[model samples]
Target: VRLSVPTGFGHMVMSGWLIEFKRQYPDIALDLLFDNRVDDLLRDEVDVAVRVMSEPPQQMVATELAQVRYVTCASESYSREHPM
Candidate 1:
């Protein structure tokens, strides 16, 4: 099965995870597309898509993965200078 993964900031940070997945599922084929836009699955560009912060369409099946808290982190000096 082909899987399409978005190569956003978070994905880039955890790029090494793919290596582990590949080792476990060596038989399955995968095609990775790194972009902010979603591709048409019917066109065969990708089979499974990993989407974050996106509402699911009617034709697609969505599975809830994990919940994460969004935190905006900045340097101490920067925050101190630009206090709210």
Candidate 2:
């Protein structure tokens, strides 16, 4: 399988999964690519891409593997200056 993943979460999150997947599917070959930039799915650069986004692109089919929640934080001074 050709897999494209982002740099930030690639090694941190997907490494474990890739290990297990390889163990289970030892016969299948994998090509892994890491980049922060969004790849063109229509061009078939990668068969699958692991991305963190509010929504996936319109052109491709997606399956939600997990949901990520982001917390916004700031210093006391910055928070005080920009009050919600």
Candidate 3:
């Protein structure tokens, strides 16, 4: 499978899912690509992708893997100086 994932993808999948996947399907070859941009399906650049998009693209079929949350953090001094 040609898997296209984000450049900064979490290690959770790599550490577990991918390990098990390879173990279960040792014969199936895998091409792992890391990039932020999504490739066109017509081009056949990748068969599967994992992206952290705010909204799904109109042209592609997407499934909700998980809901993402945002957090802001600052140093103690900086936070005190710049109160929200």
Model 3, global lDDT: 0.77
RMSD, one per candidate, in order: 2.5, 2.7, 2.1
lDDT of 1 by residue, 1-84 (tens): 666665673376436777787898898766766655565776856766777765777778999665546788889999999995
Predicted model with the maximum lDDT: 2
Write out the backbone clash pairs for model 3.
none
Q: What tens digits encode model 3's per-residue C-alpha lDDT throughout 31-82?
A: 8877678757558578888889988789988997777777898999998999
What's the best-to-worst order under lDDT? 2, 3, 1
Q: Which parts of model 1 have CA positions greater than 4 angstroms off?
A: 9-17
Cα distance off (Å), candidate 3, residue 37: 0.3
Highest TM-score model number: 3
Off by over 4 Å in 3: 10-15, 39-41
Q: lDDT by residue for model 2 over 1-84, one digit each (tens)?
A: 888888878898889999999999999999998876566654766888888887777876789998777889899999899996
Q: Considering summed lDDT, which 10 consecutive residues are worst modelled in model 1?
A: 5-14
Q: Candidate 2 versus the native: TM-score?
A: 0.75
By TM-score, is 2 or 3 better? 3
Cα displacement (angstroms), candidate 1, residue 57, comes to 2.2
